[model samples]
Target chain A: MADPAYRAAGEGALRIEPLGELAAIFDRRSQQTHLVTQPMPEILAALAAGPCDATTLAARLADSFDLDGEGDAAAILAERLDELAAMGLVEPV
Target chain B: MSTIRTLVDLLAGRRDAAALAPREWDGVIAVARAEALLATLAHRLSGAALPQPVAQLLGDARAAAAVATAQAMWEAEMARRALGPAGVHFVLLKGAAYAAADLPCAPGRQIGDLDILVARDALPAAEAALLAAGWEWVKEDAYDDAYYRDHMHELPPLIHKLRDRMIDVHHTIIPPTARPNPDAASMLDRAIMLPNGYRVLHPFDRMIHCAAHLFADGDLAGGLRNLWDFHCLTRDFQARGDCDSGTPDGALGYDEWLGDMGYRAKLWGLGPAVRRALHLSAALFGDEADYRRLSLGDRLFRARLLARDDWGRETRPLLRLAFYIRSHWLRMPPLMLARHLWTKWRKGRGAAR
Candidate 1:
């Protein structure tokens, strides 16, 4: 038998909205708190471009971060998307 | 956030010492908030003397794992005793068994009421024994009690007089009104007894029981949750190498087993819900689906068969009339029509007093 508290989370469907701003804020939350001198401009550029899917935006932002893996970029992007979705930023659409 | 982050670590089996970068922090926070709410409920109910944080985490983890450990422990203990004296035979059903089987440490989904099965002939004795064990008969009108006992598989649920736990004693595997007498009792005859003398439903019977419960239970209300249970149980059953082939005589054959369940889920516009359940369960416990008739793509099929087939001669005319209006838009079956008319006539005559 499922307890009510556990069941509530399963039923609570996250909704999407405010297409652009939500994405930007989540994208920031996806990264670190300390704004490094160099990567900040690139993140800003990516967010400034308006609402974009993770794949394309992550690709654009890759040059700013010295990382070897696509997984790292994807992971960061996915976390941002989750944060955005939780905040009612981007939706399933 | 710390709670959720810790939960993720626990779930991932990462206990040593780990540092969370800024990026992982928010996800951790969201998970923690969700975990906290669930943990709070568990702590309140478990009655276990543990550290507050530890109890909360176990509760939270149980919630995420979708299995009720605390409730299950209580029910299993009660069930052991309830069926012990009668020797009438009983088996732990659903979450209780699933938890016992160690499917997952998390409490399985919703734990509204404990469900158990007893011998049909032993129902009276079983009811008495349950009452003796501190369960109070739910105080419903006699008509409702009679309605449930005669028509439904289980009684109106017995709440523990002391602990406030709810128990559902079932004599049949499915609702009697569904499909003009579903074969619930027949399944019990084939139930395999545990080494400890308790009975566990035969694998095939168990699987079919789940399907029947989801299909025939009225209201189509908990469609999503029921489907999720079906999906998880199916996957779990399959993964344990407890396939239809290994099941004794009446078990579902591989194709039929998967096909029937898959088809039913797809037909009911429940594909998305099923998919979500499948994905979530699989992610947690690696259960796979085998497609038989319907491809994964054709998900919008109508599952009105269960609700449609037994409209007449089953449910009360009032409820049946609602079903009739929704589907056929006209009431038929002259005998039922006559019965309704006669009942109404009697009611009116009595009212004249």
Candidate 2:
């Protein structure tokens, strides 16, 4: 419950296309296209390597995204991962 | 009404969605819903310009379609697992088949029932396997069940207790008692295996099946969507060069292959249906170069296809009733149809009493 590990589906499961500002991700796993705005896309991209817990995923994401947020970055990213899992784009490991 | 036509034009990519006024958009939505093609129209108009409400509605429809498609595929997977132990390998049919094969008609296609075809000999086994896997009989009436078993091509419909989704196990495409019967065993023999451990009819069989379903088995209900499927599938086949033997006819080589491979022996007497299917598709969706003339009956059939009004309701009551009678007529001989209707009417009267 604290920092659940999550795994994005294997390659070719999600077809990510950039649409101007919002990114359109066609999740072949779910066959649902989601128009996402921010760190959600980055989180799934980071998880593409393999399954990892929230803190580790946050660390992986920090290389590209600044993790200096008022609310904890790991905490926020964990919520986004939960959201993605709800959408069936990522699975809770 | 013109609303259905607008919806079709939008789907055929002839009419511009952006140019539609707000009032016309409402009618488009209504007619699309009536024809059970909202998701398909949504996919057709996706990412294109749209009114705010229309876009929102279509976006929701797109999401619903995704869920429907996933659920459909899952049902197929479950059926596969269930039938595997029973030694019955089922071939996915219609929308399920299209989605599994990722056909051009698949995107945002609304799938209701999960249809599969097994060998006629395997009907009992397939029904047993499905029942064992939580699929329960939908009709408890003895007459209904017996009628389906005896006269229909498919087993009486079964619904999974948990999923609430229905499945139709078919041995053939149309009823045995119907006017035009297709050869199902040959289709099963020619079925192609997908990587996902499922099977679909061969491309040619799929086309023939669609045409047969539209022109032979059914009345003109939902004809537009079926015709669109025919159009898209034909275009997809052409794009993939399934018929690119540089034939002088400039028609699809598969059309000739329908002869060359001697599929004619199995096509029964469906030659006119296939011809009419192609003519209707070309007339509706093709450009001027591809246009084909329609017969007087074909014109009326087109009217039946577009008989919905602006409020998502069927408008032509008399025409609808006529087609309903015609469907039953085509489904059975005069004597059998009379008996079937009389029994049904007696039951209705008893219930009313």
C-alpha lDDT of all candidate models, in order:
0.48, 0.81
Question: Model 2 clash pairs?
Answer: none
**Displacement of the residue B327 alpha carbon in candidate 1, Å:** 12
DockQ for candidate 1, please give it. Answer: 0.01
List where candidate 1 sits over 4 angstroms from the true fold: A1-93, B1-68, B104-108, B194-198, B243-253, B256-353
Could you give candidate 1's per-residue lDDT for residues B1-353 as a string of tens digits?
33332433333334322343434433433443332323323422355454555455656655553434554454665566555756757766765655444443224345457788876778888888888667887776575576577656787788876556788888775555443243446556766655444566665455555555544443333333344455456655655545323453335565665665455445543334344444433332232322233334322211221122111112234544444443211222455445546766876898998
Model 1 chain B worst lDDT window (10 residues): B304-313
In candidate 1 the C-alpha lDDT for residue B196 amounts to 41
Look at candidate 1 and tell me the lDDT of residue B229: 53
| TM-score (C-alpha) between model 2 and the true structure | 0.76
